[model samples]
Target: MARVERDPTGDVCPAFEQPEFQAVRDSMKPNPPGEPRSEEEVLRMLRDSWKAGHDKRVEDWNMQVQRDREERERLEREQEQQDEEQAERPEGEGQKIEEDNGKKTKKVYFDENIAVGDTITDRPASYTLNKLKLIEYIELFYFTPDGCRKAQKESRSTASTETWGITQMEGEVVGLQPISALKLSKFVKPDTELSWEEVMLGRHAMIQEMMKLGDEVWPVKVVEAFNTMYAALDAHPMRRQEHGSEATVKYQAHVRREWYDRQARKQGFNIGVINETLLRSMRDEIIDKKKTESLREVSVQGFQKNLYSFRLPNPYPSILSE
Candidate 1:
């Protein structure tokens, strides 16, 4: 191979030259320079070219095949890498596991009266709510530490970044779903000197109202938490009173009176001694009604009239008349 300084170009393989394949034509004379050859002559020239460049053509074909194989291998490696990356990523957590029929569900110590030191657990098991007293309901406090810590962390972030956070606490001011004990007694009205019997009536009225209403709708979490708390409360040692029979007797009397009156009303009669205080209250109510009526009287005229009257201004003679 050689290059001419006058015309710089890549080396053309001499094996592809016509003279190099003259042996294929057995030294046959070529068509005259610039003369158009017939189809047969063109075919003969192509055949001769192929015969001379057989090695060169094979080398070129092999190179192209090698390049294609490398490209395919590179693509396969890339695909494998992508698949490995996908496999490495983890899935989301806290998905509910389907319960097994043969396995007994685990129960945790659920106390609805959530204390500060109590460890709240989000367990991987089903639970129940147990109750002991009619007024004292149990509640669970599972969201305390874990939920509150997360909430606190969120407060830290949001308080630093957002406008609402400016007014909100950067740290938690309270634990998750903290318990607020109710002083609502069925036998005593809250913040009032109402008697236990009066409280019992109010409670009865409330119960009646509750019975008249449809089922309460609570969120799934709320229901579960309540159930857990009740279960613990029911199992607690203090669930049943050890003493106070006198108080119990008094309460039972009130309940029995209510039951008796209810049954008696159904039979078109009245039973049990009505409370003296209650009777006094009814009498006072009647007296108030009579007093209100006594103060009332029929009006002869609903309103005194100030009828609109227009008077012609003082009748005066004009200067022109004078």
Candidate 2:
């Protein structure tokens, strides 16, 4: 008997008309009505989604690392050129100084720590105290070697030429007001004599009082007493540690991201939202509670994402409807 091929025009395609086709297709389709997904199936879907996100994050991190590597190389080349130029330059040609009656006073630039007994002979200074009353907490903002190069690269891309050709200056220093002095002012009454011993002993009491009072309200007398006591403390040689143009700033083992937020508040700025990389870095940082408490601001949420999810529309709507 001679074999005959199936007709081209048929109710269903030959491929779809096979007995095994429907079973294979149905198996690949989503769970049917009245049927719930198994735990294994749900877990599989979740794992797939997580894997997709993980892969994306890893890709981003790798790209960033590559960019960082390139930036470092560029910076190293620039630094070598700068060192050569520096060597050729005259000793004091570009030196900046302050002259008082023909006597050169040492100028302590940024990142240099200023402690008590460090006299500022410069007339018409911004601060009231000619000599530092307290060392306080030195807020140091730093960029790592890689971070500095990255920042420079970004600056260049943004048309900022100020940081151009700069390589070695990795950080800045900000001297904040003394927390102890601020607390001591709280305990001061108009007629109450300020004792150093009491100031040390009542440190805890001062904290309690601050918490109880809520917002700080410094009276005129209290302010005057604070200034007096602060000045007196500075004058006392016994209380003075190593002073002058010394880099005495030592940061805690691990700093909290909230510390920057608190500083931002003091400086009158908002932290707003940060990127995933920064958010992860912040979480890893562990700050001392004592430092946070001294900062005097309640913790606020950091690096929170506001997100929503929805299913994508099917592309073949006409076919699906049919």
Candidate 3:
């Protein structure tokens, strides 16, 4: 008899249709509730699921940390080996050294500890003294002289003729009247006499004081003088005709244009017409003539579609709705 042949599709394997396999497949299907699970059971399931996920994440992170640590250690070992090799090499072989008289003379090094006096020969003592004198003069002018004047009648004594003489001379030198001198004399302490050195130093001090006063007051004087000169020029019979003259007008215009151009160049701006254009733009901005859309409107428009669920309402509902 011929051997019976089994049809592969028609015949099912016993293992494939086993109860264990069927149970596993049924378990994979979502739970169908008869009644909702107890709160304890639901909480226990959630905790188990979370613990499993956390364990898997921790394992992955640990593997990554191990790999990074090994790589870092390998690089550190390589660097250490390189450093050791470099240290073993002879200095003369590694670096070029200049020989002077068959001996190495190291280059001179300077630091803050190296005295300035050591480097500088023949420094003038008088130079330092002069600097000190200048500082003293400024201090006296701002602090001492001002204090003395402010003290007025409170600072007088009879013993020191020198102090009285100096005060009298100071008043006279500065063109104060006799009554003003007497009033000032009440401010001077008679016993508060300066030494001979201080007296001699006073001349230089006075000169420096004058210079400081001149510098401080010169700008105001210049501005006043310029205003007076401008007024005088305006009043002069020649000025109107001169201003009307094409050549004179052209010269003044050219000077002003050149000055503006020079200023623009100094400030790293483009000169000529570009500077004028920029200045005009700046002036328009300062005058509040320029208009721009509200920042809130611009921002809202930019992100209008991208926003998940946000909405903007009219701030003034009547105006916007209308």
Best by lDDT: 3
TM-score of each: 0.17, 0.23, 0.19
Worst 10 residues of 3 by lDDT: 134-143
Q: Which TM-score value belongs to model 3?
A: 0.19
| Model 1 TM-score (2 dp) | 0.17
Compose the digit string of candidate 2's lDDT tens values, residues 1-322: 2222332222222343356555644454468675766545655555566567666555666666677799999999999997787677788543432234367669977655855566422121111111112212221111122222333344345443322221121136344432221222211221122233333333222222323333343234433443343333334443333321011111111122343345446642222222235423333332344457655543332212222344578999999999
Task: Rank by lDDT, highest first.
Answer: 3, 1, 2
- Give the runs in model 1 whose Cα sits over 4 Å from its true position: 1-27, 30-48, 92-322
Candidate with better TM-score, 1 vs 3: 3
- The whole-model lDDT of each prediction reads 0.38, 0.36, 0.39
By how many angstroms RMSD does model 3 differ from the true structure?
A: 34.7
What would the per-residue lDDT of candidate 1 be over residues 213-284, giving only the tens digit for each residue? 324422344334333332332343432443222232233334334543554465322222333354344445
Candidate 3 — what's its lDDT? Answer: 0.39
Give RMSD to native, each candidate.
Answer: 32.3, 36.0, 34.7
Off by over 4 Å in 3: 1-35, 92-322
Model 1, position 311, has a per-residue lDDT of 48
RMSD of 1: 32.3
Among all windows of 10 consecutive residues in model 2, the one with the lowest summed lDDT is: 244-253
